[model samples]
Target chain A: MKNLKYLISLIIGHLTVFKHIFKKPVTLEYPEKKIELNDKFRGEHAFDVEKCTACGTCQRVCPSFGTIEIEKEKDENGKFYPKNYSIDLNKCIFCGNCVQYCPFGAIKMTQNYELADEKKSTLKLEINTLKRNYFDNIIDK
Target chain B: MDYLYFLYLELLHKWNLPDYIAMVTFPIIPFCFVAAALIVVVIFLVLAERKILAFFTQRKGPNRVGPWGLFQTIADAIKLLCKENITPEGTDKFLFTLAPLLAFIPVLVVWGIIPFCNEFDIISFSINSLLFVVIAAIPILGILLAGYASNNKYSLIGSVRSVAQAISYELPLIFVLLSIVVLASSMNLKQIVLAQSSIYPFCGYFVFPAFLGFVVFFACGIAELNRCPFDLPEAESELVSGYNTEYSGMKFAFFFLAEYAMMFIMCAFIATLFLGGFLSPLGFYVGEKLIPNEFLANLSVYFEQAFWVFVKTFFLIFCMIWVRATLPRLKSHQLTAFAWKVLLPLSLLNLLIVCLIKAVL
Candidate 1:
């Protein structure tokens, strides 16, 4: 009776696995097919230049020291704006602290997670790259 | 083979060539055919396992190499060929070098023992089924030598487990084979197949009478192949790839090639033993009905026989892969216990049943 039960379960297990053959595969062909990300997913940082008063709250609130750098400058309208704002992504741990603690809503995280690069210098996102991330997210939405 | 020799001799006679030339060249044709067939079958079997396993897990398998990853194994073979052959230090150099060849060569001989179709049994002889069992066990020696030469504790342990597994499983395997031999009343594999043929194709299969033997043989075949669920020898978590751990590049490729080739041949052997090998399950040959030209129809029947052999072999292979995908590795003690306690008695019972049936018939 024990052997019979074992044999029945073995057959059941095989039949269960066999049924999976006809069902649709859940794998995405990585390069060709991209997975859908959540709306509030924290990926690469997107900077809104228009909203920034350059108070450098993101630089202070960031958990990793030196992950975010803000260089303040005076524009022709005499308002503070960032001149050489660069985020060293190598140090950034995607903690979302900068996005959470921002006073002026100047920075946000976008769903642009393909941030791998060959060089450390390339990984550091500059003002232009950050601005592009913001625009890209907008276009994505 | 006699037909082939006659045709070759006739062709030589037409050209005023010597009969000795035909004799010399005829043997090479089957050797080349077996070698080519081994490569093709092993490559496709690897791809099939991966594709089928992926399907079982709800994932897309290797679709990047070629259309549906058809060239994936070919590309892998090329990659293995290009890699440097690295022999580690503190190893017995001579035995380490010879081990893979020792493991692989026996499989090539075993492939020839299988009667593929009516006229294509490459190395036919009386007691050829017994010969299959003898030659198949030789790879264990190569594996044991590999572990001994590697100077690695893990490899040694793995090889030791393999020998134990082989010994225990071999009894049930042979007992099942004994039942089959009794039913067929012949030890020659070709004769065994001929014995299975009747007016009703499917009912004529030995699988009907020796169904218990079939199940036992299939399990023993998996254990002999050291496949998944019984794959304690190469248990990745414990042994880090087992007896071939110290081998790399083309040497490692030989071990890999031998394994897949052995799997194909083992499935073919099972198909021959139980499933009415090369016999059309539909009770008639398709070529005889479809083809109008007598000579072409005769030629096509040989190819069709070979086709039926492959179809049955691949179905068995699919079941093996399914078992692999479903089950986890067995505990070492459980493996041996299953063989000795569970399988041994079952196979003996199967033998008794077969003998009684044969007597009654």
Candidate 2:
């Protein structure tokens, strides 16, 4: 009787696996295909240079050290503006702390997540690249 | 084969060549045909297994090499051919070099023993069924030599487990084969196929009488092939690729070729012993009924017979793949225990039932 049960279970197992052959595959062919990300998905950061007051809040709130850097210079009107801003993607863990803590909402995460690079130095996004990211992704959307 | 021999004789006579030359060259014709067929079939069988297994797991298999991944195995073969041969230090150089060839050559010989169609049994003899069993066991020695020479602990363990598995499984396998021999009443493979022919083709199949034996033989054949669930010899998770661990390049390719080729031949063997070999299950040959020309119809029957053999063999192969996809690898102790405790007794009972059926018939 036990052996009969085992045989029946084996048959059921085969039938279960056999049925899966008709089901659609869940694989996304990388490069040519991409998955739809959620609205709050945190990927590469987009920066609005006009809204940023060179506050350095993003650099302070970042969990990974040296991930965000800002250089500020006072203009003739005595308002601080960023001389240079850069984000080292190697150090940034995509934790969304910078996006969460930014007072001016200048730094936001975009859905452009294909960030692989052959060289580590090339992954550092300068001010121009980050602003372009905001224009290409945020403004266009 | 006789037709080919007569054609050769006519050509030789016209060319003013010796009769002995014709005799010498005639055997090469069949050898070339079998070798070419074996290569093409093994290549396609690899791709089929990959595609089927991919579908079973809900994934797209190799579709990059060519259309529908048709040339994937061909590209792989070329890569293996071009790769550097790596023989590790502290290994026995001679045995390491010879083991893969020793493993591969017997499978080629066994392919010649199978009666594909009525007129195409290249190496048929009265006791060719027995010959198949004897030749099939030699690859185990090659595996043993590979493990002994490799100087690796995992290879040694894998080969030892393989020998143990083969020994335990061989008994039940022989008992199953014995029941088949009883049903067919002949040791010649061609005669076995002829025995399965009747007005009702399905009822004449030995599978009806010795269904238990068929199950046992299928299990034992899987074990013998070192396929999944019984694949202790090269358990990838446990032993890193097993006996051919240190082999690379064309040497490893030889082992790969031998394995898939053995799988095809084993399925073909099962089709012959139980599923009625090259006999059409339709009760009548379609070619004989449809073809208008008498000589063409006679020729088409041979092709139709070969087609039936392939269809049955591939069906069995699909079942084997299904079993692979469903089952987890058995523990080594459970493998031997199942063979001895379960399969042996079942096969004996199957033999008894087959004898009763044969007597009644």
Candidate 3:
């Protein structure tokens, strides 16, 4: 039976060789075919200010010390609202807890998956840039 | 290098009797060429695989080398080649030297019987040449040799795992091969390719109807190659380079090249058998339209032949890479159990089906 096994393997060895000759290769020539990432992809974090209620939920929930800060101001209706809030992108783990606990749906996850930066300050992100500049663009629109 | 080539060429001529005789003696010529091709394919496979994984995992793989990092492999290869070769002092020097060669020989040897041409016009290999199965055993032996010779406890452990996995996986692979042999009714790879040239009605190229064997064959092949999920022998984070732990320099490079080479050969083999070697996907027309002239069409068929082989190999390599990116390496015991418990029974069943179909048809 053992010798029989050797003969059998010898006789049939080419099946693997022949079967592989003419199928569409699984290689996707990239740059030509850019893979699309999903919107809520848990990549590195991007922050939005218009979405941020400035309730400091992001800063408060953050376990990492000195990672986040929120500055408050009076809105047009005299209601206290977030004027300036900054989360150290380096410190922020993208825990999404800030996004989750936001009572106002102001904080959002962006599709910008890439977050590599050379400068140290680049890591210390200000969420205002990611905000929808609705008032700034209202007249332009 | 030129002097060396000259030396090899002189040696080849000295040994040459007829083209057929020369073919057997001069396996190194074709072997070298094939090995080179596999290395290139492996690089391409690595890049494509990383990119695919990045896509699935929601990230971009290396995109900085050339536009979208097409030349990333060249850079990486240069990097590895240039890096320091660190040989551990507390190792068996001779066995350490031999280990990578042991790990690599199987990949080269397996290429011996791949039927690349239909009419068998160009090559001087015999009318009845089938050496691939024999070559397949070389790497298994090589891995075992590497593990023992490395003289590391982890290396010892990995070598044992490799032995166990190779023994268990060998059964299903052979069974799957048996199914194909039954279909073609010939052990010769060229004969098998000739068998596939004429399209059949139901059992088309042993993929459909006999697809169960194809699946099992592919799975076993993956385990045999010691790739992801089955990468117990070289489970990097755990075993610390596994069987070749003490290797360094060109020695390490040889092992690296051989690992990729095995991947390329196994992938190509799987693609050729189940997918249809060098035959146009629809069995015609791609070649016809590419060159309206009949003579050109004949030329295009050769391209089509090479093209299909390339494509199939690339796809299988991609799948291997995909599994690598997605799944963690399998535990040694789990790897054995999967080969025995899941793959073995399924392949046996697949063999039974193929036999029944062959008997009926």
Candidate 4:
């Protein structure tokens, strides 16, 4: 009777495993498929050159200094325009302060968070690269 | 035997090959075939085990290497081959070097008597059952040599555990095998399989009458192979890979290969003795009707037989993997006690029952 009990337990244990052989695996192949992130996910920053008034509010709100840089320069029309704007991604902590504090809505966080780079210098995104990366990830359709 | 001799002569006549050359090369060819089959099967078995374990644990394993990780073992093989062969200081260099070969070669030798398909039998003997028991015992010597030569305390402990495990388990295994031998009334593995053909309705396998013996044999076989639940010999959490702790590169690869190859051999042995060998579970008539080729039917019939053997072996292996995933390792004392207290008496009783039945019928 004890032997029969053990044999039944063994079969039950095996049945539990055999059932799993048919179920779809829970592993999402990361490179081919990305998990959907929530709307409030603070990721890489995007800069809009046309909307920025260059009030430097984003720089002031940033807890980590040297992360957001706004340089002022007079354009051909003689108006003070932001020039050579840069975000040092190494120090940026994906905090929404820059997005929250920006007066003209110039800096907003995009959902593109694959921010790894081989060189530290490459992670320091210039305004153009930031604009491209942010817009590229947006599904227009 | 005479037909096999004539087969060689016929082959030489067809190819116009010299008699002396044929005589010299005839014996070595079987080993070559076994070795090739062993390497190929081990590679696939490793991949299959990883994939099956992954499924059981709700994870994906080795899918990046090839299509569903089919090439993962190949990549691992390449990596192991390229790694530096390191011999630690204060180790017995000669014995350490020889240990993996010692571990590997005997497992290969057991394949000689395994009748894969009907026509693919390499060398069959009347005492094939005894041959299996004897060859299976030889790997412990290699394990002991590996442990002692490594000069590591952990390896030594692991090897000692292995020796103890092997000794304890062999008794139950022998009893189980002896019962089967008595039930079939033959010591020949092929004849034993043949006796099973008409016993049951669908499969006619001995697993029906000798189910207790099958259970004991399988449990002992798992212990003999140093697998999970009985894997105290190579318990990674406790002994750091057990007896093969100091081995690396191709030496470690050899040990790994030998372990999986032994799993295949044991499963095949079980399939042969109790599960109807290479006979289709649906019986020969169904398999023959499916082929329906009067001219090329013989070849197709052998193919079907080989196919059934493959299916049964893999099914048994999958069960083995499932048990590995579900169970935890047994403590050394518990492992030995299970063998001596639980399994020994059970197997002894099974043997007596089988002998009495044999006497009556």
Q: What share of the true interface contacts does each candidate keep?
A: 0.91, 0.81, 0.00, 0.62
* Candidate 3 runs further than 4 Å off: A1-141, B1-32, B119-130, B199-203, B288-295
- Model 2 off-target regions past 4 Å? A73-80, B14-16
Off by over 4 Å in 1: A54-61, A65-86, A97-104, A139-141
Docking class of 2: medium
Best of the candidates, DockQ = 1
* lDDT score for residue B144 of model 4: 96
Q: Report the C-alpha lDDT of model 4 over A1-141, residue by residue, as the tens digit.
A: 997898799788878877887888898889998989988788887777877767788889899989988888877887777887899989998889988887777777778778888999999989898777556654341
Error of 4 at B336 (Å): 2.1
Summarize candidate 2's per-residue lDDT along B247-353 as a digit string, tens digits: 89999999999999999999999999999999999998899999999989988999999999999999999999999999999999999999999999999999999
lDDT per residue for candidate 1 within B85-178, as digits (tens), equals 9988999999999999999999999999999889999889899999999999999889999999999999999899999999999999999999
TM-score of model 2 relative to the true fold?
0.94
Q: Which ten residues in a row have the lowest lDDT in candidate 1 chain B?
A: B1-10
Task: For each candidate, report its DockQ versus the true two-chain complex.
Answer: 0.82, 0.77, 0.04, 0.54
**For candidate 1, what's the TM-score of chain A, rounded to 2 decimals?**
0.86
Residue-level error in angstroms, candidate 3, position A79: 30
- Which residue pairs collide in model 2, if any? none
Each model's TM-score, in the order given? 0.93, 0.94, 0.65, 0.86
Docking class of 3: incorrect
Question: Number of the top candidate by TM-score?
Answer: 2
Candidate rank order under lDDT: 2, 1, 4, 3
- The best-first sequence of candidates by TM-score reads 2, 1, 4, 3
